[model samples]
Target: MPNRCQRLLAAILLFAAPVHAETLLCHVTYGGETQDLEARPVSSPYTVPVQPIGSYFLFRIVFQKEPADLAAIKLYVFADRDSGPLPIQQATHPYPPLAGKGAGFGFTGLNQVYEPIRDGELQYWCEWSPSSGPAR
Candidate 1:
């Protein structure tokens, strides 16, 4: 009986594990699916200090693991009041590596560019909206 249960458990563990990608953009999964993600404190987990000069957004994206996986995550800072469901940011990046044995990994910097709205408060959005996820 115990042997049967062990075999079942091993099968479940092997089949259930997600198929991690080959390339290492981030050392862990960002959310789960939806490939893209917003540059927020929660979703991003890591962050960097801002110099505060040109129009830019500074954020650090990290996944703790054996090796630090890093890449450029796209971000768009918008006028908060700018409406149409939600404020938006376009992300263009290669998918990161999966977390090895420890945590995940990623990168951070001020996205320098002004994709502006005329008049509104400052708000932002990316594909990976962690808001929908359970709080950590």
Candidate 2:
């Protein structure tokens, strides 16, 4: 009887374990140089930071996991401006992306973003996967 109870408790605990977290990874390129950007689930999109890409563009990514049914990932691109950053483009994808492992969904091909004023070209692609550990 004691062994049966122990097994039942273990089964309950196993089912209650949280799902593994997911990660969004992107490779951004500008002016002959490339850099990697990573984002994890966050409660608030406002907490994410805008990253600079080369001299003319700023990039931002947001991953939301709460309200589980509406989980989503968003990507934003901005053109650097003297007064502030100007929004250029935005992309959103439903969580657990339609693609299977090793295949990521994003702006179809080599996504090219242009800064209206400087005419600078920035390219980027992104993928999502179950978090294995610390980001690279």
Candidate 3:
């Protein structure tokens, strides 16, 4: 009893419904952080913060690759979590206030960090030859 056009349209729509299928995407990692890519590609590189330590000694961190999509940082010289801050701290034992003459607290080596690819919350990390800490 329906018109030809209406019947034809209904038949087309019924056949056009989407079929459900599950696909796995590659997992992504950066500076030691990982996230599931949901069968899709991530559009940006993950970033993390690195703090320098102690002015008493010069500190340096050599990234295997600058702005690496995901990399493993190597720590050379002064092994352990307590040698010296990456940038080297100047010993602010007496956290001097007001004047800039006090020792500046800092970390002293190479570290890895992973930022959460999530919304609303974030993650940060700091690795020092002498010490390490997690920041949220």
Q: Top model by TM-score, which number?
A: 2
Q: Worst ten-residue run, lDDT, model 3?
A: 88-97
Residue-pair clashes, model 3: 18
Highest lDDT, which number? 2
Predicted candidate 1 versus true structure: per-residue lDDT over 1-136, tens digit per residue: 5698899999999999865322222211212222233233223434432211123222223322223354434332322332322334444443332222222223222233342543222222222222333121
Per-candidate clashes come to 18, 0, 18
Model 2, global lDDT: 0.79
TM-scores of the models, in the order given: 0.25, 0.74, 0.20
Comparison by TM-score, 2 against 3, better one:
2
lDDT of each: 0.32, 0.79, 0.28
Stretches > 4 Å off in candidate 2: 1-20, 100-109, 133-136
TM-score of 3: 0.20
Q: Write the per-residue lDDT of candidate 3 for residues 69-97, one digit (tens) a residue.
A: 43333222211134533331221111111
Q: How close is candidate 2 to the true structure, as a TM-score?
A: 0.74
After the best TM-score superposition of candidate 3, give how far the Cα of residue 48 lies from its true spot, in angstroms. Answer: 34
